[model samples]
Target chain A: MQPVIRLEDICKIYGMGDTEVRALSDVNLVVNTGEYCAIMGPSGSGKSTAMNVIGCLDRPTSGRYYLDGIDVAGLSDDELAHVRNRKLGFVFQQFHLLPQLSALENVMLPMVYAGVSSAERRERAAEALTRVGLANRLNNRPNQLSGGQQQRVAIARAIVNRPVMLLADEPTGALDSQTTQEVLNIFSELNASGITVVMVTHEPEVARQTHRIVWFRDGMVQHDNMRPADLAQMTLTV
Target chain B: MNIIESTRMAVKTLTANKLRSTLTMLGIIIGNASVITMVGVGQGAQRYASQQFESLGPNVLFIIPGSEETRDRTFQVPRTLTLQDAEAISSQVATVSAVAPQLQTQQPLSFRNRQSNSLVMGTTPDFLSVRDFGVDRGRFFTETDVQRNTQVVVLGSDVARKFFDDTDPVGQQLRIKNISFQVIGVLESKGAFLGNNQDDAVYIPITTMSNRITGNTSPYGTEVTFISVNARDEASVSAAEFQLRNLLRLRHKVVNEDDFTVRTQKDALEIVGNVTGALTLMLAAIAAISLFVGGIGIMNIMLVSVRERTQEIGLRKAIGASQQDILVQFIIEAIILSALGGVLGTAIGAGGVMIVGAATPLKAGISTPAILLAVGVSGGIGLFFGVFPARQAAKLDPIVALRSA
Candidate 1:
């Protein structure tokens, strides 16, 4: 299998002088291309830290990070930004949509940073918003949209530049059960279309929707429930 | 992101809070207005003084008795110059074109039932050209009028109007110090000089003034007031002044400091210019303090804005923005605020200058360099003051920023 992300003994420590806290230690993980999975854990289990490192937002204290076969651990801050821009898309629990911009404009932001031409950026941003079922709400601001719709807009923004992997941190943590299902369905549809989706969450129900689950406890991986049937099915479908 | 995108975002953010932006710009506006107005008025006053000197005479110099140090110490200038000195300069100095020696006294004048205290000046026929006065009616007294000691007077316009009731004052009789004199000519209007009205004085023959009026003639060839001398041309003024000084020192037999001081129009204008220039500088410096305060106001607001928008910064960073990007965005916001303030202040200051020009005797014009300077300074201030808050915002950890909000 072609791997999309490979982590070797990653460690992240915070503070020093006897107050040092190891947020992550010896965390080895890998996800294949086009896989739909979730990283699940309790509070302080370092799943969030793992997500940050994988997304290239934070560097690990000691580790080897190979994102899409690119050695990201040795990357400088500027190079990491380029990796984040081209290799990964991020979604937060808070639905971080800039309030001043319209839904379409918010979706256009990543492509703007990607140095995409304005005409193409607009066309692709509109297409991404259409894919998220937000075609009609493209001009609406974040405050005017419902919570679920805002999350959908954020999804469109994350995917507008056509990233290789979508990394979500508690993506449905703030939503009602009905909207949670709606967002999860969108994620499943995105995965079926040949995109890798790696999600971090404490909710078992959210974890169950994914094909595989990696559980963490006390700064280390404690469980891996990768079903062979689901993997075969994922390959066959894609 | 490009500068254009950053600027666009900055505009959007600033326009969201219109009241705060306008209030922040008020200090710069007032500062610019005062600077423009004070400088414009100062320039206008200088121009007005130069015009007054031009109207005095063409290439004229005043030979005042005594040194420059004691010119203002006494009311009367100690009569060290004489009518004979003026004649000697007119005859001997090749650069000298004309010379008019003046003798002055304040005396009550009467014509029919009207009576008033008036300034009476006794001068030669050369006074007509040397003092730039024109005879509006009849004719000025001839040189024979002084040798014969004829009691003939030329009335100034205001004096003519006061004593003769606007009737032709020529050929009329007027009494000065209770002595009857015939008005042979009437002078045209000459406006105020150094706050003293030039149109209220009457002119007479210098010999008649010494013989019949003041009767203060001495053996030193008739004591007189200042001598007004006109050079042959503008190029000859300094040469004539130097020659006159040497002639006077020899005539007065001075071995130490010279007894007479020659004053040029340029010298008087320089003194007036220095005073007005200092006044303008002081006023502008005071106004610049307010501009400085306005820059501090921008910095204060930017700091508060950075704190309030921490989450936004984190979001931008999370979405592929580098630290440099965040820094540029905040810095652009501050620059937009200050540059916009500068433009608005310039418009207001130009308007104020025009208003002051319209309402007062100072015909102040809007100075282009002043506008450019004020605007450029404010923009630079925005850049200078903006660095602190922009750096602060750029340095925040995205994890902490996202967590805080």
Candidate 2:
């Protein structure tokens, strides 16, 4: 598989002088296409910072980032937004589905930014919702849907643009175990369809389900490709 | 995102908060309504004044005492016009057809037990034609009546009805200022003009009125209130006015600005139009302040809305909406609110115009250009005031926004 993402010496700093906060320090990473990976870390470990950078929500203070083989280091904010729209899909802890839009409309959003015609947007949104097992719930508002259903709609929205990768941060953190499994199953199915999935979760049980784990501590990766069985039982710390 | 898409989104968002949206539009609604109604009333006043002036009789002109500047600042008629001026106009001016020298005084008149203070107009026989009055009964007193100082009076229809109800007013005698006068004629009913009932006064000879009743005679012959002159035809009205002014100036002599002013019906109508136009402008300017205030209200509400919808902004941003898209969405929402307000206000204002037209003497109508201007201006105000708040929304940091949510 080709490398969909490569990071070289990525550093993100948050303040100046004595109050300076380094969210990421000399972070180097390479994630391949179609890889299902989990980034695990405790509080202030910079995993969220990495997610932000990888999702192109924020720019790095220093270093080069290549997404789908194109370096994103020198892109403008608008250009970066385009990259995010076309190449990356973000799923958040709260699902973040727009309350004003229906499931179908929410799924149509990225395509709207992509400037797709309404008919095409509707058709593609329906197709995406159907793939997420939400064909009958296409017109339901976010408030009208269950938590699990809302998360599915969010996932449908994320994948509607046919992005290269899915970037989820604590995606199932607000969900119960039953809904979490439903989310994990969808992620697995999407991964099997040749989409890379990078998720950040603190739960070892969740991390064990992924193919690879990158654990962070003190704004740096303490371990890469670690398996749960290789760790000290359920200590859950790197 | 395209404009259509943004507009659709804006409509959805605004509809989701119906009360807030309606409340936000209240200012624009009131502002537009005032703007429209004020302009309508002003136009109506101008029209009424024009009608009243035109009804003074065809091709009529008033030679009033004092210069134009003096009359504007004072209520005192300068007594510069008299029978002499009227006689000179009727004889010397070629464009003149008839002249009515008028003197007016409110006097107590009694026919037996009916005593009332009524307006008494003193004039010669020419008052019938120059003032567009018709004698309904008996003949009007002739010019010989003024020469003899005969105490002959013509009763207006209203005065005839008041003093001699159900009986013929002609040949009846009425006492004015303790002097007895015989009614020789009755004039036809003339409708009110500018709030004064034209058919509610009595007419007498100017010589009898000055010598026997009021006893206020001037050495300059007769001090008439104002001289009413009619041009030979409609085409001669302005020419007549120009000639009258020149002749008066020559009579008064060595004038810098002249002591008297001759004005046509058209001039009076123009003066009325200017006054009403200024009133309309003042009203519209006040209404504009409200519109400006409404625009500020929109900006204030939009700023709050941006704050309230920060999470939504963040979510949309994360989902690939650019800053420009968010900006467009908010601005479009403001425009929709304001334009809708304009339409509603126009409806209310037009209804008010119709009601005013029906209930009052003013025939106010809904002006089309005013409607267009108000609606266009409100829409423009929405766009103008919406920019800062929309920019505030578009410039929010997505990461911080999401974290707050």
Candidate 3:
């Protein structure tokens, strides 16, 4: 089967002249449909840059980025935005829900940009919020909701367009331990339902929850390995 | 995004910071108000001027002593026009109807106890028909009064009221420059013209004026201040003017530069129209500058708003918003502010005009074209000034924006 995302020899360089910095270098990776993966690294290890490339938010200096079988590395800014809209969903540690919009309106925003009709946008946003267990808080603004609820609203927004892969950067970094568990459980449930989930995290506990972990050090991938729990459970079930 | 949705979002964002939005709209409001008000006042002034001119009688022309250049150069106007010239035009000019010669001077008039320093005019009985004046009581002096150089005087309504109050002043004696003359008639009110109360003046015979009052300063026979002539019909005004100019030139004898000027009512109206129209344009232009300043204010605030909302822009872009979406949203916001201000300013300006009309003699009214133009200009300003900031917002990189946030 074709992988949901494929990156080949990706390199990202920032600035120019004496102050040049390499954010990502020669990174090749692949993740199939329905796979749950974690990108792990120390500070300045280029994990965020790799996430940005995978999310189609930024282009690499030299690379091939194939999202859902279409090469998107050389696309124009607007075309990249279209690809991101159709194939990728992003969740940030800050939740990033618009402070002025109600939770439902926040979820409906992507569909607005995507040119969805008003009726369909409303209905679909409601369904997405229900799936994220934010049906009761649909009319609440971000400031009116708790951290976990706000993150749940962000998740609802992310899945509102039904993107092919969810790319999260430190999704649980701002939440407490209890809220982190709730957020991770939602991610796991979403993944179990066959949506590919790729996350970047520094915490070992969060990394261990994923089916696979790719470690990065100094702008390059160091290891790509499957989790022990997934291996043992697969062996027992088979 | 759709226009309606963008407009809705713009309104929502602006209402979220009501004070800032209101302050940003203030310049446009003041600008539109001033423009509309000035246009209405200018139109009112034009109407008032025409109304005053209409009171001067139909198909009337004025023969003034001295040319425009001579009048400008000399402090005291030269007494070049004479009573014989007026009589000659009355009898010889075929298009002429009647002629009234006037000699006006300001002097003290006194009754038994009251006194007033007012204008005293010496004219013929033709003044009643030529100037469209009506005598309220008693009779106007005839040609006999002029030939006899009688000192019988006619008091205007206000002058009569000032000396005699509600009592009749006919056949009463009044002193002008300490010389007593009997009041033969009291005129009906003719209202004020160009700030001078026409009803505050008294009238007598031109012959008496030259003989008794400011005794003939000119060597010319029966020197008159000016001659007012009526045309037989409106169509004959130009013919009458031409005939009178030729007659006067012949009477004056061999003049390259004619000593007097003959002006029709149309000429006076055109000059007044030009002056008032130019003044209106100047006032409107001054008001438009405030609109431009308001537009610049909008641009300034919008740029600051874009900077403040950089993170919001990033988030929207990340979720698939195109650059056009961002641009439309900001531009719509600016339009909403300016358009709203325009509507409010129109209301205020119209209300002010109505109030002024009620309080003053000016019949000022709301001008529709002025309102439409002001609103259109302000809205266009909003759109024009909005582009720079909106483009700045749209060009922002989501990655850089998000990182900054």
Candidate 4:
């Protein structure tokens, strides 16, 4: 019914004087509800910065950001944190699962902040882990899990709160090819289940799996295009 | 976040670094233990002193000659108290139970071949009841002995042992100040009082003392060191003291400052109480500094922990943990450390007090208020010192923290 993330001419500048660097410049982007999209760019292309702004992790220097119809630019730090907890889930390249917590606890963390009851948090976290094919690895800590399993745990943590949008930053950047394919299959299944997923990736092949790709370069969005599976199949047949 | 969740997380984190946590807690433990032990010992000393004063016979009052200022300023105490003044107090003061005028001097005591420096106390027969001394084997001197100036001596229990080891001391002759005096009776053992061994002193008739040895040091009458007056009862102590002061002031005549000072047992108890109380306070204050230092130690270690766990903080924040969550986590960790240390220290300190009670004469006791205060103060110190490091951890920018990690 509404776009899950919307940014209008967002500019994020770091440092001051001659050392100033524009991490993101005049960026306008929108991802509607239930859309799976990939943001692609080289190093220093502001793709990560855009993902940060969309995820409510950092504020923009100038311009408006509406996350799930709420004005994120006007919210306080705690309010932004609540929005992150309730509306968006994050999967990092490093899997950022707290090493001290088991996979189940890591997944339950978001719901803890969401004020969910302990029993419900346990139930939902278990279900989320099962969704990521990590039901048997619930008691394993990040150190004990394989790279792919750790990534899956991180993904479960990201989606355990049933966030409106899932934001992943190079989710398979640290995994082998076989593990990367398994993680992508998980993401595909998650997107198919009606959750909007946005990922920032340096791999062209990774971007090709998504329904749409938005390319970023030199602190600006250079191109955006839809490459639906049916259209790709039609192109291959032609 | 709920407090339970934060507390659990805090406990988890602290237990993760068990050695570091214990080392951090050591300062608080020592601080609390010293505070409890010192307070207990100080209070024990006060109790022991009070008990000693109580054992000096009930409802006893001392009438010292010369004002406190005069006593301090003069080389020797002015002999304002005399046998006449003691008689006046006994006759005129209705509240007085008994009056024992005393004159003390260190004299060489000789019997056969054994010779010892003995403290000789010159007092009337009333000294037996007024000072709570009893004859163990023989009878004390009669009032007629004082009137007749009899050369009779009463040997204290220890004095009897010292001179007549296997032989009977009573009815035996003991030479004092080169004057041969007969020991009429041996006193029952009255142990040490304020470091002075009462058993080492023997009593003689006041008249005999003024006539034979250490002649009159007072102008008015037989010069006495002080008058030991027993009140009729505990309630009559103040009244007796008042009447004694009035009699002495009238007898001294035209006094700008009364040349005498009367002190009751309660007054002595209070003075000892105040001294020991102040000492206890001082010890606790000094120990409190260590608690403060312990707080600082906690702050220092927490700052280091915050710096070390930057990634963990960043991850928590990114996972939608508010700054308050981070703050509470770190603060709770500190409180847990200090609170645990406080509990442990209290146990150790109470045990130490028990050991002291068993080992020494102080009757050392555990003070509940002190234990509660030490534990409460340690917890509060944790919260106070934790704020800075927790704030530092909370204020860390997640993006920067994540980048660094």
Candidate 5:
């Protein structure tokens, strides 16, 4: 089967001459539809750079990136934004929900950007919040909710547009262990529903729950491990 | 972004910081109110001056003797106007309504034992009509009385009130400059004209004053200080003025400059209008400065707002808001503030005009064109001052902004 995301010798460099530093060098990667993958690396290991490139937030220095068989490097800024909105959902470490908006309004943001009608956007946002087990907390603002609930609201916002894949950058980095486990459970449930999930993290336990793991060191992939039973057990526990 | 969604977000953000919003709006409110009130007061003064001038009548023309150069010194006095000259103008000048040759002197007049310092005006029967005076008690001196140099007098309302009191002054003997004259009539109350109290003056025959009172005979002709002529209407005023100037010039036989100045009511009104109009414009201009200061206030506050909401801008951009969306949001906020101020200013200005009209002799009229211009200029100020800060907000890099918090 064709891969959902294909990165061919993707390279991202910062600065030039004596000040030059290569964040990602000749990296090739693939993730098929319905697969859950985790990218693990140490600090300054190029994982974040790779994630930024894959998320269409930044272009590669010299390489082709294909998402669902569409070339992302050639698209303009606005066109890339359209692709990001339609095909990828993002969950950031800070849970960047607008503080002035309620949980439901935050969740409806992606659909609003998608140009969905008000009635339809509200309905879809409600469904997304319910899926994240935040049905009762829809009217609450970010400051009024716990850290876990706010993160869940962010996740609901990510999935509101029904994107093809979920891109989480340090999803549980700011949460307590218990809240982290609860959020992991939500991610596992989403993965079981057949949405492709690609998470970037440094934690081994977080990586152990994914179907495949790609380890990076000094801007190059070190290993790729596929552990089917571990992914199965993680989904079953959630 | 759609305007509705942008406006909703703007309102939400502004409401979150109520104190800041109110403070920002205060500048605009005060600015608008001051502009309205000052301009209204200025306009009121202009109207008052014009109305005062209008009460002097529209058809009357004043021809004062002596040029500006000879005004202070006693030169050869002109003897151009006489009783015959007044009669000739009345009959020959087609546009001339009436001619009242006047001679004025300050003297003491007495009736019975009552005496008062009063103004004595030596003029013909036509003076009553030309000067907009009417006899309240008895008939004015006729042409026969003027020709005969009759020692008959007419009492002004105040003169009658002071010397005659409740007693009848008509047909009674009154002593003017110690000369007894029969009171033929009582003049109506004319209030005041050009600072002279018309009600305190006594009217006698001009021929009597030139022949019997002053006792002077000119080498050229019978001399009079000034001649007052009334035109038939507003349309005939200019024609009568032209005819009188030509007639006087021909009679004086001047090879160069004439010694007399013929000033029409319209000339006086125009001078008054120009002076008042200029004053109004200057006041309005000063008021506009305050509006500009208010705009600057808006700009300063908006810059602060942009700084305060840096994180908000980042988050919105992250959620897919375009740069244009941010620009539109900030610009709209400024426009809303200024437009609100304009509305408030208009109301304050109208109220100020009304208050001035009530409190003083001036009539304050609310000019619609001025109001529209003021509001439009204020809003334009908002839009102009709002652009720089809005652009600064829009040009902020999203990544840098997100990292700022």
Candidate 6:
């Protein structure tokens, strides 16, 4: 099976001349459909930069980036946005739901951008919230919801567009251990349903829950490992 | 994003910051209201002045004597107008309806012992019709009185009231310049014309003033100060003016500029209209500056809003909103603010006009075009000032914005 996202020797640099900083240096990455992968790295290891490139939020300085065989390096900002909208969804550490909007409205946001009719957008957003166990909190604003509920709403918003992959950057960073496990279960269920998931995290426990892990040091990948079924079951029990 | 969704989001955001939005709208409201009110007042004043001019009778002409240079050098009054000229215009000129010669002088008026300074005008009986004056009491002096140089006077309504109180003054004696004359009639109250109170004066025969009062004689005939000619109607006014000017030129042998100026009531109104129109425009412009300031305030607030919503913008962009979508959202927000302000301002402005009309001598009128202009300008201010902040929001990089979150 082809990889859903494929990067060949990607490089992204910041500044120039004597002040150059290589945020991503000769990075190669792949995540196949239906796989749950976690990228683990210390601070300043270019993990977030790699996520940005994969999310189509930024272009690589040099090197090819292919998502479902479409080269995104040369795509214009609007075209990149189109690709991001149709193929990938994002859940951020801060649970970046618009404060003014209710959970239902926040979930409907992606469909709104996709030009879905209001009636259809509401129906799909309702279904997405139901899937995230937030059916009772649809009309509640971000402030009205708990940190866990808000993140769940963010997750619902990410999947409402029915994108091919979910890209989570520090998804549980702002959550407590209980809420973190609840969110991880949702991610696991989504991946079990054949949706590709790529998450960026620094916590060893969070990394252990994923099916595969890629470790980064500085700007390059230092190790890649797949968890055996026994190890995955032991990690889940812990 | 679609316009409906963008507008919905904009409204939600604005409502979330109700106090700030309401305060910002106040500036535009005051600016637009004041603009409408001031323009209405200025327009009302112009209309009032024109109405006053129109009340003086249509197509009537004024003939004032004495050239600027000649009057300054000689310091001597010219004996130009005579009864012969008045007769010539009245009978010979087909367009002339009536000709009334006037002799004006200041005099101390006394009824018994009560005395006051007043203008004494000597004119023919046709003065009543020609000058648009109505008799409120006894009859005016007749052509017979002009021929006889009668020592009878007509008191204006105010003069009659001052001298006689409640007593009828028609058959009473009134001393003018120490000359006792029987009051033959009481003229109607013709309110102030061009600042001079007409109801405070008295009128007599022009011949009586030349022969009995001033006592200045010329070999040609009794000299008159001025001649007021009334045309039959508006259509005949110009013809009468043309004929009279030619006749006067012939009589005075005016080879260069005439020793007189002829003006119609319309011409006077036009001059008044120009002055008031310019004043209205200037006042409207000043009010528009305040509107511009209000627009800037909106822009300032919107810029602050963009800064505060950086994460929200990034999220929207990440969710696939194009830059144009963000731009539309911000611009639509501004337009909604300004449009609401404009509607509020129009209501306030109309109320202000009504208040002025009720409280002051000024007649405040609401002009539809002025209201439309005020609203249009307000919307334009919104669009113009909204561009910079909206562009800034649109140009933000989603990566940087998301990182900031």
* Highest DockQ scorer: 6
> Which residue pairs show backbone clashes in model 4?
none
lDDT of residue B149 for candidate 5: 91
The C-alpha stretches of model 6 lying farther than 4 A from their native spots are A226-238, B66-88, B103-122, B143-153, B162-164, B171-182, B192-197, B204-226, B358-363
Ranking by DockQ: 6, 2, 3, 4, 1, 5
Question: Candidate 4, residues A1-238: lDDT per residue as tens digits?
Answer: 7898888989999999999999999998888998889987677889888888898889999999988888898788888888888888989898887777899998998998888999999999999999999889999878999999999999999998888999998998999989999999989999999999999987766777888988788999876665644333422432
Model 1 chain B — which ten-residue stretch has the worst lDDT? B27-36
Compute DockQ for each candidate against the true complex.
0.50, 0.73, 0.66, 0.62, 0.29, 0.76
Angstrom error at residue B391, model 3: 1.1
Per-residue lDDT tens digits for candidate 2, residues A1-238, read 5699899999999999999999999999999998999998878999999998998889999999999999997787778788989998989898888888899999999998899999999999999999989999989999999999999998998999999999999989999999899989999999999889999998777777889888888999888777766655534334
Residue B311, candidate 2: Cα error in Å is: 1.3
Error of 3 at B317 (Å): 1.0
Sort the predicted structures by TM-score, highest score first.
Answer: 2, 3, 4, 6, 1, 5
What does candidate 5's lDDT look like per residue over B59-171, in tens digits? 88878776545555676656555656677788888898888988877888887788889888888888878877888989899989989999999989999889878888888
Task: Specify the poorest-scoring 10-residue window by lDDT in model 2 chain B.
Answer: B213-222
- Candidate 5 Cα misplacement greater than 4 A, ranges: A1-4, A202-213, A222-238, B62-92, B100-128, B131-228, B252-265
Q: Cα miss at A188, model 3 (Å)?
A: 0.9
Report the lDDT tens digits of candidate 1 across residue range A4-67: 9999999999999699999999999889999999987777988889888998889999989999
Of the pair 1 and 3, which is ahead by DockQ?
A: 3
lDDT of 3 by residue, A1-238 (tens): 9999889999999999899999999999999999999988777989999998998889999989899999999999888888877777889988888887899999999998888999999999999999988889889989999999999989988998999999998999999999999999999999999999999988878878898988788999877665735444433332
Model 1, position B383, has a per-residue lDDT of: 90
For B271-385, candidate 6 gives per-residue lDDT tens digits of 8899989988998999888888889998998899899899989998999988999999999899889878988998999999888878855677999998898899888888888
lDDT, model 6: 0.86
Mark the regions of model 4 whose C-alpha exceeds 4 Å error after superposition: A226-238, B71-75, B106-118, B148-151, B162-167, B171-180, B207-216
What is the C-alpha lDDT profile of model 1 across B254-345, one tens digit per residue?
89877789988777677877876787778778878888888899899989888988888887777778778888988888777787788888
Model 1 clash pairs? Answer: none
Q: Write the residue-wise lDDT of candidate 4 on B106-131 in tens digits.
A: 99999889899989999988898888
Every candidate's CA RMSD: 4.9, 1.9, 3.5, 3.6, 6.0, 4.0
Inter-residue clash pairs, candidate 6: none
In order, what lDDT does every prediction score? 0.85, 0.88, 0.89, 0.88, 0.81, 0.86
